[model samples]
Target: MTEAVSRRTPGTPCWVSLIVHGLSATQDFYGALFGWEFKPGPEQLGPYVRGRLQGEEIAGIGQLPPDRHLPIAWTTYLATDDADATAETIRSCGGTVAVGPLDAGPAGRLAIASDPNGAVFGIWQAARHAGTHLWGAPGTPVWNELITRETSSVAKFYQAVFGYEAQAVVSADFDYQTLHLDGRPVAALHGVGHALPRDRGPHWMTYFEVEDTDVAAARVVELGGHILQPPREGTSGRLATVSDPEGAAFTIVRSGER
Candidate 1:
């Protein structure tokens, strides 16, 4: 068992943010679904807004470049010590850098990249901002998982870059692997062959912690969002699949336990 540590220091993970195509619609959609408030940012940031869950900074949303030809999606950002070094390590581990170790002023430096299997994530070097300040709470980010077709390649790539250990868990329903950091489970990897739908692409899905799955599901539809999967009980908690107005998919879990 390899013990892994976050490149970020203690009390990190202060916030998280996503870049989408539409900003107003995305902000309004998520704001209503999660009861979040948005604070506007500069124009260069492209309609950026800080997402607040129960008055705490949990995540953010912004608009992507028009010519990027990228789909509206959510990307997870892990706190790190140095974005440049992290990007270098990602390249050495068979990952591709999509963006730069660019400065975000008060937010910090960031770089966007994809794993060997094509799952996208970000690295953050917090100068003034950490990550999700409020996580594992109602209407906040709870967990993240990378679902990919090439499990072995993805596992090896992330382990090499982050020093994470992959632990396989077997069950009658599904066989999943959890990524451990410092002996603590922080993320999960699911093989696309058996666990996910055939049409699914390699991507990182973020889960928001909620208070009631049913209520959240209803609110999702009410806010013009779509509930891809209704509330269902799982081993971890009550889970639901949802998509924002612009079709960015994400999950929600109502749980008191981590």
Candidate 2:
């Protein structure tokens, strides 16, 4: 198991969470695939649990509100010193803050927002609960990336909101840029042009590390999830795109510090 640490740097990809319709079934699917144990969390919102591996927090799963119909997807949260200030910056930068900079019962203050391109993400100001606790282990999130229609404008939007230093990849075929914080690459933006998924829209994708991409993909299917993309050789390692039973998509990769 990898060691646990608190990520407090503002603008870093600190946590990934999912709000699903069937909480129990979603827990079952991910538990089987990633060996995650659930622990009840702040009830201020609703039924929520933090996913742990060998007692280290990795991610969060929560129940969706019954009366409200929203997209089933993973949200990549960026760490911030003040969520309200970040929310204002998002609005000034042409992004939309849809949810609250409200309290999660003293655990943290959070706000859900969307980029100008409609890619949803979150801003977190940690108090008692520091974002994600473990890394470089199978079943823990390793990376967060944004997939959008274009990189130039969205890159500026993030740079203004988060103080990220954008470094564009000089390539004729690939329109990509890596966002850096304190000289360390924290997240990335990929311009897929017209190839962006219509159903999912432009969104930030959360990538979980696995021991073996093929085996993990198979396990996802066996546990009632669907493999949206078959295992392929990625620049980092073997990876595959898969979605939970409720159709919330995320990627699994066999690459991270072991």
Candidate 3:
């Protein structure tokens, strides 16, 4: 069991959000799958709510922008001390800051950006709300990783913007590297080359912790979601890639469950 946290180390993934068209239906899917309760929050955003588990905030779900056709996917937010500076640094690092370093009421400041490889993520300067409150438990985020065409350049971009120390994990056949901050493994990068999903492109994939990956995948299917990958043994545990009813992709892992 891991302790609940109100704050996280800067440069590490602090929050994840999903924007979809049907808020009520999406909420129902995740709530039934992960046992999440919803609460309206950061009202500054048009239609948004925070998903909580046993009173601790787990993630966020909001209505998609009515004007644009944004892909339905989870966006990982990295903790930062200064959103303005981080947004500038992202621009200088050859990344694009598509949204604001603006305030989300008193909750925090935020900016949406994408790496050179076009993997979108967020920079969060937390205030009263310090991102996700609990982790390492069932229904909470356990890992955030970048899946791109190549790791060399995008890794450098993240390192320059967030000061992540890149350590090559598998360089022979697979180009994988772990991103560390203050000597702690915070995130990772995987270069899958031509295998990158044409519809999805490069993106940050969020992995949530569960008690049983197989059961969770089954539950997702029951809730009108789809399993992109069947339960498989991963380095840390059993995991499966799944998408919600709205088509937001995320991974679920059951640690130490062989």
Best by TM-score: 2
**Alpha-carbon lDDT, every model:** 0.75, 0.91, 0.90
Rate residue 29 of model 2 by lDDT: 90
Once fitted onto the true fold, the runs of candidate 2 whose alpha carbons sit more than 4 angstroms away are 1-7, 256-258
The TM-scores of all predictions, comma-separated, are: 0.88, 0.97, 0.96
**Higher-TM-score candidate among 2 and 3?**
2
> What does candidate 3's lDDT look like per residue over 30-112, in tens digits?
99988999999789987999999978898999897778688999999999989999999999999999999889998999999
Collision count of model 3: 0
lDDT of 1 at 9: 43
> Lowest-lDDT window of 10 residues in candidate 2?
1-10
lDDT of 3 at 207: 96
**Most lDDT-accurate candidate:** 2
- Model 2, 1-258: lDDT tens digits are 454455578999988999999999999999989999999988897899999997888899999888978999999999999999999999998999999989999889999999999999999999888888888788999899999988998999999998999999999989999999999999999999999999988999999999999999998989889999999988778899999999999999998445
Ranking by TM-score: 2, 3, 1
Least lDDT summed over 10 consecutive residues: which range in candidate 1? 2-11
- Candidate 3 RMSD to the real structure: 1.5
Error of 3 at 163 (Å): 0.8
